[model samples]
Target chain A: MADYILGVDGGGTGCRATIADTSGKVLGTGQAGPANIMTDMDTSVVNILSATDAALLAANLPVHSYSRITACLGLAGANVSGVAAQLQQALPFANSSVVSDGIIALQGAIGDADGVVVILGTGSVYISRRNNSVTMKGGWGFKVSDLGGGARLGQKLIEESLLVHDGIYKRTPLSSALLKHFDNEPHAIVRFAHDARPNDFGQFAPLVFEYAAQNDPLADKILKQSVETIEAALDASMHDDQPVLSLIGGLGALYGPRLSVRYQPRLRTPQADALTGAVALAAKLYTQTAQS
Target chain B: MADYILGVDGGGTGCRATIADTSGKVLGTGQAGPANIMTDMDTSVVNILSATDAALLAANLPVHSYSRITACLGLAGANVSGVAAQLQQALPFANSSVVSDGIIALQGAIGDADGVVVILGTGSVYISRRNNSVTMKGGWGFKVSDLGGGARLGQKLIEESLLVHDGIYKRTPLSSALLKHFDNEPHAIVRFAHDARPNDFGQFAPLVFEYAAQNDPLADKILKQSVETIEAALDASMHDDQPVLSLIGGLGALYGPRLSVRYQPRLRTPQADALTGAVALAAKLYTQTAQS
Candidate 1:
């Protein structure tokens, strides 16, 4: 029987590792670089190991203690065909299973209760759980998907700012502020965006919400359009038999109040985070297996 | 007097060089890689020389003949502050002047006559000349600008296709066709977009126009929205006096017919390509100086 359990929460921004005892008591936590498997499977795998090693060290366990651990890894892009299975085979843990990042975030947010989670950070993912069956939408990544995501919002902000710069669109406080941030040079913003990652774009997301509150027309358009995408996703997942709903992530709070009135009453704060959910799942899966 | 004249047209897609004698007869022409100064000035400079050397070779002129060549380079991003001056200092020529790509295209289109040119390719730029004064709009680069250009159109196609895949958007022929191109896997598209350059996305542009002609709803929306941006840019650049307007570049022909009725009467064909404009300007500026 394994002596401990390991949980990994990985996404576009970073990877996190949690080590806990069989009784579900947390030991230590650690973090590492980006671990979106679809972006780079090899890089994700490397980051996972690095985070796990850091967690083990924090727990005062030897690196080889991975042999005594059963792990549950919740990874971004785990929904892609064969990615989870491939990762399963590659891990050094004694026994481990892989699940989507959305699954863990849902698990973390609602615990054992049936519910839905709209994660709106650097990337966006919509996940619902009813009677333990989970449905996931979006969270594809920054390139083409992740509608209503921070990266997309930030991207639009910059794009619109340039339009304002060219007088093609009327200038607003948001565009004015963004132009100033880039030193009033559209080309400077262009240079920043050319090599920027999703999180880099995400940094500008809060400004959209901040400006929208001030009645910035451009910001209102950008945010409302994003909200429309989010509502559409929610419309598909929030069924007739309503489940508890939670909004979670870096931009989650900002987006929560912006959701349509139909969803306002259903919204609840998450009980915990994806890392916590990962740790709980690891303990339950491994300790139960040991007992059986 | 310079032994030969060189004309260089550089943009995001590639650069072209032409070598001719003082009498305005083109001796040879050559092409090289992308030379958008905003994107990468060093790369642009390198491509300019590579294309020039090939043109010189074709004209039976030594590479060292650059030292005695009076040249004019019409370059994308030349309007960016200090870029043109920096480039002028860096070029190996007897005498040279730098102008925005729009300027050369304007010269090439109307031959010192009053007119406007809308270049719609992997990128977009609006340029108009009236009474020897030039007005340029857009053409800032793909990351934050290029609203109606091929790259932006293709990007929207992929983004919408993913929405279709998620069932948030109704499927259309255009989305279906694009999904098929990416092997019906949204992840493949996400992968493709992660590292896709502007021209890479531009490759799918013609397909949008093709599908739009069939009344594919998504394609129509995408095309119409792009047309709106084009019209807006034109509205800013096209004056009340109504100068001759020529739509040029890879997608220009497709965009021309779709323009609003207001621009239809003013539409005309480009007299020559950007390279030809560069050559004519080179010959005019240098020959005029030599004669005087």
Candidate 2:
């Protein structure tokens, strides 16, 4: 049996790997470039391997020790057709399984409990687990959905800025800042958005939040609309059993207090990060198989 | 001086060319494949030439008489930096100029009259004219703006369909039809959207309108929201002298009755189509230069 377990959390932005013992004691963690399986499977595999190798090296283990490690990889685009299967077949670990990044986030947030985790980052998704059965809402991606995520917020800000430029929306300091950022050229914003990825748009999300704190009306309007969508998503994810809710991701804490009062009592902090949850999953799967 | 005037209306879907005498009398018209300069300038040039050649042939003129033509091209993506200049230099005519597709649409709708034309096709844009002075409101393109256009409606349909699939949104006949169309697979919708262009999403716009006609509540809600945005755009377009309002494009007629009653009295039918408008502009420019 493998003496070590590995966990990988891969997304469009980057890939992170954690190495731990069979008993769930973490030894080291490492990160590498993006590993979006849907975009490029080969690159994702390479990134996963690179992150794993670095984690093992950080744990004082030989790079070749990869073959003896069982791994669970949770990655964005894993839910796409044939992506997870392809990644599992391409992985170098002794035994490995691939799942969506949302699943790992849910695992990390609730740790086998019946609950839900709403990740608000460059993208947004709601992952719920009840008695080991898992379901998901949203996370269709940036262009089609992701409602209240940073990317969506940033996109709304740009749209409002352009409207202000056109004299359609009232000009405010927020819109002025955005127009100035793009050199006061509507075409520049259009050109930038034409080829921009979610993370690229998410970079402007902080500006929206910053302006909102200063009571900018447009910023406040954008945030209010965003929170309404997020609230709707949260309401849709609930059940009579009242699963504990944990808001997770880079923007999670910032958005948490703005959520409806009804959800206040149900909100809980995550027990571990997604990387730890991935390693925990690896340990659970490998140990069970070995005992059987 | 050029003996003939040529007008070309080029867009992502296709390109149309019209040939007319210097007196503004139509000679013939022709069409070819898409000529969006931003995606492939070479293809745009080829398509434009093909349409022009066909138009000359239909006009019973020698194909080699292209040099006698003064062409005015109103093309999608021409407004992008360097595109119009590149196209102007590449066009095969005695003299040529390039303008945005929206400009020709506005010209077609209002002639030389000071007015506003709101185009509601696969994309949306508001173009206003006052004493030869032109200003634009919303043609920023899909995913960022184009709020009430076919592409946005179709994209919203897909998003709602996915939400219904995940039980986040209530299932209606519209969402059911959409799910059935994609074989009830959320992944299929995701895959289709992942690589879909604006026109691809625009293909689903008819479905939304069809369902709305059948009184589907979800469809009505979507349409209401879309119309509100469009109305906001129109209101923003109004100046001290209320310009004659012209609603144009494939979805324009359908949305006309739904607009606020205040715009009804001002709404007027277009005097000519975009192709004719292009030819008219070509005649006006070349004729003036010939006389001068």
Candidate DockQ scores, in order: 0.65, 0.61
Candidate 2 residue-wise lDDT, B127-242, digit = tens: 98876788888889896888889999999998878878877789999999989999998878878988999889989988888889999988998899999988888888866575
Task: Name the weakest run of 10 consecutive residues (lDDT summed) in model 1 chain A.
Answer: A234-243
| Deviation of model 1 at B222, angstroms | 0.7
Give candidate 1's error at residue B168 in angstroms.
1.1
Q: Write the per-residue lDDT of candidate 2 for residues A131-241, one digit (tens) a residue.
A: 778888889888778888999999989988887888888899999999999999888888899899888899999888888889999989998998998888878887758
Q: What is the TM-score of chain A alone in each candidate?
A: 0.92, 0.93
Query: Per candidate, chain B TM-score?
Result: 0.92, 0.92
Model 1: how far is B259 from its true place, Å?
Answer: 1.6
User: In candidate 2, residue B64 scores what lDDT?
Assistant: 59
Q: What TM-score against the true fold does each predicted structure earn?
A: 0.92, 0.91
**Candidate 2 local Cα displacement, residue A256, angstroms:** 0.8
- Cα lDDT tens digits, model 1, B225-285, are 9899888878877777756989898998998889988889989888998889999999888
Error of 2 at A170 (Å): 0.7
lDDT of 1 by residue, A1-292 (tens): 3488999999777999999888878888789999978658888889999999899889888765778898999987788899899889988888898999888888799888777899998888889887778888888778777878899999889888888888778888889999999899777887788788888988999999998989889989999899999998888777856569999998888898888888998899999999889888887788677887
